[model samples]
Target chain A: MSDASELPVGIADVEAAAVRIRDQAVRTPLLGSAALDARAGGRVLLKAETLQRTGSFKFRGAYNLISALDPAERDRGVVAFSSGNHAQGVAHAASLLGWASTVVMPADAPPLKIERTRAFGATVVTYDRATESREEIAAALAARTGAVTVPPYDHSMIMAGQGTVGLELAAQAAERELVPDQVLVPCGGGGLTAGIATALADRLPRAVVRPVEPAGYDDTTRSLAAGERVANAAGASSICDALLAPTPGELTFAVNAALAGPGLVVDDDQVRAAVRWAFEELKLAVEPGGAVALAAVLAGVADTADRVSVVVLSGGNTDARWLT
Target chain B: MSDASELPVGIADVEAAAVRIRDQAVRTPLLGSAALDARAGGRVLLKAETLQRTGSFKFRGAYNLISALDPAERDRGVVAFSSGNHAQGVAHAASLLGWASTVVMPADAPPLKIERTRAFGATVVTYDRATESREEIAAALAARTGAVTVPPYDHSMIMAGQGTVGLELAAQAAERELVPDQVLVPCGGGGLTAGIATALADRLPRAVVRPVEPAGYDDTTRSLAAGERVANAAGASSICDALLAPTPGELTFAVNAALAGPGLVVDDDQVRAAVRWAFEELKLAVEPGGAVALAAVLAGVADTADRVSVVVLSGGNTDARWLT
Candidate 1:
């Protein structure tokens, strides 16, 4: 089951994805914060992915997936399902590639996000997240229209594309002559964590990558510890809407389990504090899910004294309520 | 009154200052927003100065002034007085240059700014704004200690230093091949406006610079229209605490009046709206003062259709109440 054919997403694939999305996705800046350093007992290099296209790192994967399609496949369009960020990313990437896109989002998705996704020219299809399956909704739409399904995560190509963020972070850190002692990444389905972990494996051999999640939905944390899949309670909810994935993806967990450090969990109040800190000190607009890694750093989940560290602020497509 | 010696600040001064602060100051990014463009009916490039050192463009001037001082002057130390942003900038710049700093601040200045100033190793001297004068306190300190006083925006070097923001904007915009038709800048003592205006005059000759102010405190606007100086109402106040200069600085006005277009005013509500817009659309944490130029852009102060425009977000240092 774990043979070569089943594992196409090597570091080379991520490197190739980087090349494919070079001009398309934003090479976000690596930011430093003295105030954050004072709080965390270590210097911080913020991978400000909030400034990326579509206000998230999702664009990297979306662009990579859409741009790889053959003309025949492209003509049939692409379909995706996301709570918000991935929807915007896929819609934006498709529009840029001149391929049609249809995004199936939960009916209760943020209004601003829904509006923005549609503004990017993607046809919107909604389903009850509580009852109907978003994957089924998207699959049905794709089956009827002959559109290819673009999974938000879990896919080899998608993982490779998200992995490009790690590549850029490595290069940026190297250019600044900073070898991070630790890299804390916010995890949803572990795609970002897996990608970054794979990139850092060779680049910063001394560094440890950690996945951060909301407290109640620490499936990735549980999975990492148990060496098997785990799922959150079906009714569990979090203010970190973008990080509500039920379980870690199989492909993502395979890489993450190998390279990532102990998983870290932060509560909603801590997440809110992190968001406030981002605004107050870093002057950055960050959504709750994106702030988890920073929240971990600030809360001192790990010993980081006198060491170089990086926290990936992975997304910022938030509703108005998040700001308040 | 307008002799060559008195006119020490020029486009050349700004260029020289940019070189001086090359490694010391952050070269902030020029941000563009499609959503903002759609609302304003034109292309809008935001000069995100909020991300600068000390979270404002004040650092440019502070570093430039401090770094250029003679060895003896540097040893004597630097003195500055500001309600907030300039205090932090001076303190940070002085610490970087190995100069002792003494910041005379109002007793009611934001606690965060005061703490940050102290964190940078500046000695804080608080005065009652209602009775005592910050200027007198700073002058007495300078006179007693032989430390050179660093004026916020009135001095030639300070103006030259602030002008570096424009030098950067011109280059960033040119790299993107965007020639802005108009540039909106938040104005206090007019250092940033003067700096940007001079830079734009030389680099993008087609661009017209406009000074944007909060409605009740349009002193610069009144000054420019009268071809002389004007003062704000003694008791006037607004949410834009960073931009509440009683009158335009003589040196700054000289450059601005010659280069900038008519002034534009945005009210408190409009400023709040722009701040929300920056958070919601640009994914940027912008203070009330920093949001003024953006407010003018979104408020349709000018006919900006189909033309490249730049809005300078001059500062981002706010207390929690501001966000709420």
Candidate 2:
């Protein structure tokens, strides 16, 4: 297992994840709009993971991780730390597998998501963002309870599960006779971008896979440029609560560095504008974090070049107050 | 043509309309949520027409009507009168067919919808809701410009096109092996409800197709009870702007009276709640007007009877301010 861990991920990992998560994680639709196409100067297909169960693509990885746990480990339950989407995903996945789960979340997480996670039967442990470490709390809990710890994105299983998104999107696009010229994916710790890049490289060889980040939180971009894993500036934040990871995951960065094209960035204003545009045009509810890639498209980061562009709308757990 | 118009709509008409609109109109998906099913005490399938092209099922009817026009009539263009959804649909359809279109809209219609219709290149004529007749305005414009008047819901082509929603929903549900026990549709001029009822009766004979309307504009409910067509109370209005038709259409009402079950009603508050619920739970942006059937389900207007329930989320042209 250690030697295998040293090896880079392949399309086979993503294919296995798809089989593991089938019927459990939703196979979201790829939608399109003429208005978006006009703005991008090409056909823009939106793979709306917003419609996924728990309102994000995070569920695919979370569920895959939980289901892959050994029976004794699953019976001992699991512990995880997340802002919102991942929390709901793990909670719902654990509930489905009849495993007890404890999620350590930041106190400021969206109430709608907190309530939803609780509704899924996971015990929630809240911590202060600036003063406390959710990872420490979750680790301590796992130690005491003998529960398995499921890291959000660093693990191979998690990355492989997220890669299934690229697999599904490629097939769905091919079914529509659309071979994407570019695929823009929202990045946090680079897990999603890494997985998608690996899958797209195998499926759509001509497709350019790039990572999108918020302006001040462009750790992935800096990391890609520096040819190493890097961290976002401390104490910096954006409206995208779900995408505020401090640094790129070691394994994820390794995959993204080799497979991903260049990284792109969008400011908060552009993200908000994309959120409003999604409501007005695409008719999908996209959280600010999830809107970054779309914002990049609308902001011309990909420079669509009159070719077909595929953007992943990764999540939709926006606060009620943010809708306006 | 006149005799064909007099005949009640059949499944064959909807099937032919589907073929006509294959690549033109979007074939919307039937979605489901376990949380929603648990709340309703059974399974609840959502036919999300909100993601349809032009943001509503109205696109189907509008495109079907415009495409059926004779070559000479097409060259002369088309004129339509609508609250908003149908206006955008007709405007978009006309633009796609290389025809100029004019739409008579209410002065108080949502600014977002009005702007979108104009953006689709339709000429807009706004009139005071209290004292003006949009139909008369459209008729006059059609006569002056030698354009064909495309009535929003009354025409045979329009009804047949709208019925395609039922056809698509039935087929999608069948793919999942779900036979709906109750299919609840929002009622405006009753075209959608009538069309869906006709299609569902032929496809899913065990299903009960019901109409849902805003409380004050429950003309279809009153008409169904009275065994005759009836008009809404003069000057009645509700927040469900798209569902404010003065009365059911003659041909549409004929279909509904024969196939649909007793109509249900929900207040504006209930509609708003349903819209919010759709965003929060379904991760879909549903407008108030398009949420009435879901409102009826949430408000317990449809008891669901411990069986599979299907509700149509018909549009997603929400005003920005209303989202908050």
Query: List-wise, what DockQ does each model earn?
Result: 0.52, 0.68
How well is each residue in B27-101 modelled by candidate 1, as lDDT tens digits?
A: 787876657778888888888888898899999999998888886667799999998899999999999889999
lDDT of 2 by residue, B55-142 (tens): 9999998888788777565678889999899999999999998889999999999998999899988999999988988878888898
lDDT of residue B33 for candidate 2: 77
Q: What is model 1's DockQ versus the real complex?
A: 0.52
Stretches of candidate 2 off by over 4 Å are A1-8, B1-6
Give the Cα error of residue B250 in candidate 1, in Å: 1.1
TM-score of each: 0.89, 0.96
As for candidate 1, its clashing pairs are B163-B195
| TM-score of candidate 2 relative to the true fold | 0.96
Q: What is the TM-score of chain A in candidate 1?
A: 0.96
In order, the Cα lDDT scores of the candidates are 0.86, 0.87
The 10-residue segment of model 2 chain B with minimum total lDDT is B1-10
**Residue A100 error, candidate 2, Å:** 1.5
